[model samples]
Target: MITRHLTDISSKGFKVHEISGAVDTLHNHNRRDYYKIVLVTGDMILTYGDQTIEINGTILFFANPRVPHTVVHRSKEKKGYACLFTEAFIAGRERAEILQSSPLFRTDANPVIPVNSEQAAFLGSLYREMLSVHRSDYDYRNQLLRSCVELIIHEALKIQPSPNGLQQKNAATRITHLFMELLERQFPVESTGDPLRLRTAQDFAGALSVHVNYLNRAVKGFTGKPTSVHIAERIAAEAKALLQHSNWSIADIAYGLGFEYPTYFNNYFKRVTGATPKSFRKRKV
Candidate 1:
């Protein structure tokens, strides 16, 4: 499936939808551009990264944009609400950092937690409030919605930690974390002329002040993929986003993505996606 980005949500930067009717149609095993929190109450299976989890009761789950995951509903009836919002929706807020660093949203941390009846009631009420505010005519609805989002996050923080516990941090894990963060920070390319600053594994290693081979080994050891592969995948993802969402010409997109020539970008894109950039854009259209 094509990864869903912030633009796929409302221009207001947030959306809340009931989960039961939509679970079957929701995108599966794809990366998304926004944060997701869902309150599920039924039998379901979730696959996050490399782990698979089964839930049979009330639960609250968080998914970050950087982590790829999917959900499978086993029962015919499900009850819950899911809200999605972009980082920009919460930017400059006091709790933005808390939201970003919370274990519930961390890629390496367990994202699902079982909730008792009272906790489920409280969380469900918050979702209901958010849905109500979303449909209201208030001028400050976005602010109200953000507050509800923060409340949901804070509540999840108080629940029991993921059963998988915390991941032990080692040199390889640390380096890989830094590399992935640095790579993600360059994403969602904002303008046609705004080229990606770091385009290669060597560039990332240089930025991290580590030797190229050391960085590669660390990344590969932790993620089971070469550093170059990660870099190329991220670049390809951004290239697809730009080609689909921006008015920029192919040459401009190439330059913006740090390609010296449009032909190089074309070949690279075809190599990575099995389609030329123009064809990809056409197919998307």
Candidate 2:
């Protein structure tokens, strides 16, 4: 497929494009702030998460911000339309969270829907309308395009409507820095009075304003370990440093590290270090 024309997603939050030019190799993760829908005919290989999928013929595709994906063109003869939009594009919906759990955009779900000729024609016509609406001067163009986007999304799933940040070199790198900064902010475990405010992957993810899974992908992609592992290791390292360098009691250490009880801390430290905290501390003493 050949392609041309892309509406600026950065400024307006959404745009519909006619699939009229050579299908460019697309890595969806780079555009980490948006979601995408495509209805196209082509022979292509799609790299979604860690899976590689190759498809020939007509198919509809959905991509969300949480997963990293790439589409490679395998054949020249392709036709289709693609819609791109930011999450803000749908912010006005009452329960936008519904879209967050849609199987179509889930990391585990196959994002492809085989389009029969009739379905293709119908979806294609919607795309055409969207492209026009996207380029129009109508005051309600965005609203209309949003409705069209919702329509295509539902058209693909045959379902009803639902309600569904930072700067760095790239998304993963930026996310990694954010994750690390957030991870370190609760450090030193200086006092049990202020336990770690954020401890789990979910905690950090919530603090960073992203899905835990998305944060994991970015952290693991760049750091070669899951977010939880990073958090665990950081805590473990802190535990060791405290045991060796600080005069704090084991119970105090435990509480400072966010453990409610010394026994829990002992179990955790032993599991991570294969040595009980008391034993390690004695040896250090």
Candidate 3:
């Protein structure tokens, strides 16, 4: 099964489907490169990260692109709705930050949240409204849909507490967490033209408003790797994904990954993976 990217959806950048309608096509175990929200009314099991969550009755779940998860439909008659959208679709919207900061989207946070029947009905209706707008040709449908998405996020926030609300004992751990979140927010590479903006440890440190040396120490102390190493590894991972999934040429891929020239990217890829991008793609094929 392939990871679903934002471009896989409609040109409008959003789509909603009944869970039962899409279950057969959904991957058994896979990751997605867009945000997802599912409102369900039946029993099922979800393998999210390292934990297995069993849901009975109504539940609302939010998924971030960085987390890999799988859904196991236990009941023959499951009823729910799921919607997917790219970050760009909700960019500049007020609730965008909620998606990033909320417990529902945190990697370590428990994303599966149980809800009462009344709450479930409210959320299910929101999804139904989104589906309706998705099918219409209204000129302002996208704006309305964005509002719907914001409403869903706000509703979920009211139910689930923010995981970050707890105080961390160590400053290094908190800094590392913030750094990782910033790094992940830039990912999935929506377009070959949208090259990665932050490619260095200094770039991240500056964005985080911390000294470069301090950033290095914090990341290294927490993750046992230098900050630059983490940046390079993430970039390399994205490079491999593009090489395997997209039709972009090596030169284009190089530029899209923030390399000054194709040669630099080739050397970096070889250093990290022991295979040039071209060879890697060929082997995958």
Candidate 4:
């Protein structure tokens, strides 16, 4: 299995990473450590192990980091900015709470969210400003980056669409809460290299000590999707992240995501994403 390279920064918090190059292949990522905000300025394909999202022009949101995924640019050339931050960067648990509570943090059913031109411009400008401040040797770089992150989220909320449809009180209280909490605790891999250990409905069901069928029923009754569907969706979300954010090869990605054979992972990924992993990564490149 392939593991992503972790970059360390001072306690003050890191700046940001903005790379301009060939569309890179995605490695499997089944862990969660950092928060990512992406703004793509060109044609690109985003792949989560079993899902593929195409972006022509706009901003996308990926809050959870526990899934394994990757990204590919369809055109030969693409431009984008990605901002990565940790919970500490948010100052304290209080501030991080805002991020977790916000609807924007919802990465399960929908990971990549589209923004209007104006909203995109605002986010892009904020990220660009952070990148600029990051490059300069300043006394308060951490403070600046922190402020920029807050600003970016603020703008995101301003443009975020309001949640629609009737709300289900029971689902909101019992099943939904448990599902989200369980889902979050299993990111960035807790035990071994096995993806199953980190991202599976069965593992969650076992932890909860409920039959997989019961768990599935609860999740389905609430979210309209089966338990396996939710798990696969989250896994796919991570796949898209590694594909876009890292440079690991497809085989490495497969291994990292816990596939005993790359071929098995490849077929599974294509089935879910509607494109071959190589072709998906190639589009990004």
Clashes of 2: 12
Which lDDT value does model 2 have at 58? 90
CA deviation > 4 Å runs, candidate 2: 1-7, 24-29, 95-98, 101-105, 159-231, 234-285
Candidate 4 per-residue lDDT over residues 1-285, each given as its tens digit: 011214543343453666466664443445556556766666767775335778786765564554445766566666667776665666455456556544334333345667877777777788889878888899988777877877776666666566544323332334444566667655643222555554567776654434566667778777788877777777676666666667877776777777778898788888888877777777675
Pairs that collide, model 1: none
**What value of lDDT does candidate 3 attain over all alpha carbons?**
0.75
Q: Is candidate 2 or candidate 3 better by TM-score?
A: 3
Per-residue lDDT for 282 in model 4?
71
Candidate numbers, best TM-score first, in rank order: 1, 3, 2, 4
Candidate 2 whole-model C-alpha lDDT, 0 to 1 = 0.74
lDDT (tens digit, per residue) of candidate 1 on 115-200: 99999999999999988988889999988998888888788777855343134344457568768977998887877667888989
Point out the worst 10-residue segment of candidate 2 by lDDT: 160-169
- CA lDDT of each candidate? 0.78, 0.74, 0.75, 0.63
Ranking by lDDT: 1, 3, 2, 4
List per-candidate RMSD values in Å. 9.9, 10.8, 8.5, 14.5
lDDT tens readout by residue for model 3, 1-285: 223434446465777777653344233544454678888776678876545778778888877665567877776666788888776777674664666555444444557778887888898889889889878899999899888887887788788754453432244565687688779878888776788889999998755546688789978988899998899899999999989998889998899888989999999999988999989999776
What are the TM-scores, per candidate, against the unseen true structure? 0.61, 0.58, 0.60, 0.54
lDDT of 2 by residue, 1-285 (tens): 112323477778887776765655654455567788888888889876555778999988887665567888878667888888887886565525545445334443446778789888888888889888877899998888877776676676563223223322254665676578658767878787888878789987765556888888888988898998888889999999999999999898898899888999999999888999888988885
Q: Which candidate do you rate higher for lDDT, 1 or 4?
A: 1
